[model samples]
Target: ATATATFTPTATATATATAMATATATPTPTISPTTLTVAPASGTYGGTVNLSATLTSSGSPVSG
Candidate 1:
């Protein structure tokens, strides 16, 4: 007596993926205004004057 063998083949599967992405942009920073004052913008020889300055960022004072 002889026996016969049978073979079965399986099919392969393929998948596709899609993705969407978005980015937000940041606004540019504005420069802070600085004011400097010196008593007696001009001085004579051997004269002394006071000096002061103010700095601000986003309406807040900056000090060091």
Candidate 2:
């Protein structure tokens, strides 16, 4: 009489991954207070004058 037995099994695994980046700060812009007016204040003596300009911010009238 004779008897024999054999069994084999092996397994190994490893993994790693990482990434990170953060840094932000940007905010600064505010300055509004302007007013300008220019029109036909006066013009005489053989001349032709035509001028007009008016711009405001707090008064509510600023267009381009």
Best by TM-score: 1
In order, the Cα lDDT scores of the candidates are 0.72, 0.83
- Which stretches of model 1 miss by more than 4 angstroms? 39-64
Model 2 weakest lDDT span, ten residues long:
37-46
At residue 23, what lDDT does model 1 achieve?
A: 100
lDDT of 1 at 25: 100
In order of appearance, the predictions have TM-scores of 0.43, 0.32
Go through the candidates in order and give the C-alpha RMSD of each one to the true structure: 6.1, 9.0
Q: Kindly list the per-residue Cα lDDT of model 1 for residues 1-64, writing each as its tens digit.
A: 9999999999999999999999999999887676543344566679986566566666676777
Global Cα lDDT for candidate 2 = 0.83
Q: By summed lDDT, which 10 consecutive residues of candidate 1 come out lowest? A: 34-43
**Model 2 C-alpha lDDT per residue in residues 11-58, reported as the tens digit of each score:** 788878788989998998887898987775568978977778899888
Native-vs-model 1 lDDT? 0.72
